[model samples]
Target: MFFKKEKDNFPAFLLTSLVIILGVHIFALLTSLYYILPWFDIAVHGMGGFWAASFIYYLLFYTYRGSVRMPCFIAFVVIVSGTALVGVLWEFFEFAMDIINIPFLGIGLSGKAVLVDTLLDLLMDIAGGSLAGMLLLWLKKNTL
Candidate 1:
């Protein structure tokens, strides 16, 4: 019972970790906005799959490690749901920015590709998040 408090404290760490994870999403926000000749544009698009994969791995760790005392089923659900929500939001943000005359650090905007590209964003977001999660497990093991 002594450690119960510590385990319940997972939310704090989870939120911090998620914030850092969300920072990557923030970068995605920048990338989506950089419509023309954007920065590292090719690598960004290609790495989408990898990032989604990490999200998967992150969930795996949350489940396996997090479930020790309390069932992590809900954590898993929350993580997945939250990631998906972010992915959808990215699309909306991109589409909205294009329409609202928002400037992307001087990069010209493009709106015609919003629908198709947003779908791509969703796909890559899933892939990248899932992969990142899995890789994190391996990373923790190696570091330890």
Candidate 2:
């Protein structure tokens, strides 16, 4: 098998990340918080980054559980890189949504607003990834 079958808290971490992302997203959608609060989108993008990073980290941890050693720096790099990739893809999705003039989840803006929003989203994504990386490192140091 490529990955060792194991019991680990990684699953719990991933589940919690997913729950936070989805919960916040649903709340934002239901209450139009994304429109009412300027920072809501930023927070959602941050959580998206966290979720993406956690998924990538969990996959690596699972894949190398017994056969390979992952240094902290490497883990941090992978988590951030993976989150960036997902963030870029998500931006593309938003661009497509804008092209189609979709509501709610779409950027729905032109020119400067779009540029600023995209940059902020990317920044928040990286920030969230960094936070996740630090958390994972701490957990690994103490528990794994």
Candidate 3:
């Protein structure tokens, strides 16, 4: 019943939004749009990071009923690290899928391409996570 709980609505909503975004990406991949559209991967990765961070933000605050007086630096670190961990896990999943020859979502990259792609994805993830972290910190200071 966790999904039915009132306090879980916002996180559920955030996750739903992520599902929609992922659906779009999956569609693009299936249609080979990523091959035609160069920036598609970058856009999806950045948005993934943003949504992942936002979901973490909501999760953290929703679980804490006391005063939301954490230092800005600490909050930023928590958000960034959480988001980065998610991103890394995703990369690992992709690698594992490739090893298992899963045709659905693997990028199917070789040595240099795999390294470059992973690094760029991580960089974009960090960029989006940092933005979310800054916004959350600002909101906590001013509104929460």
TM-scores for the candidates: 0.46, 0.85, 0.85
Off by over 4 Å in 1: 1-78, 105-112, 137-144
lDDT, model 2, position 119: 94
Cα lDDT listed for each candidate: 0.51, 0.81, 0.81
- Comparison by TM-score, 1 against 2, better one: 2
Local accuracy of candidate 1 as per-residue lDDT tens digits, 7-115: 3544565566557555754675666734444443334533544444444534554557654332344434444455566677756766666667676522233465544
- Once superposed on the true structure, which residue ranges of model 2 sit more than 4 Å away at CA? 1-7
Report how far residue 98 has shifted in candidate 1, in Å.
Answer: 1.8
Task: Please write out the lDDT profile of model 3 over residues 24-65, one tens digit for every residue.
Answer: 889988988777886788888888888888888876777676
Pick the lDDT winner.
2
Count of steric clashes across candidates, in order: 25, 0, 0
Deviation from truth (RMSD, Å), model 1? 7.5
* lDDT per residue (tens digit) for residues 1-144 in model 2: 112332365687678768878888878877888878989899889888888887887777766655656788988998899999999998999899889887776867788999999999999999998898888667766664
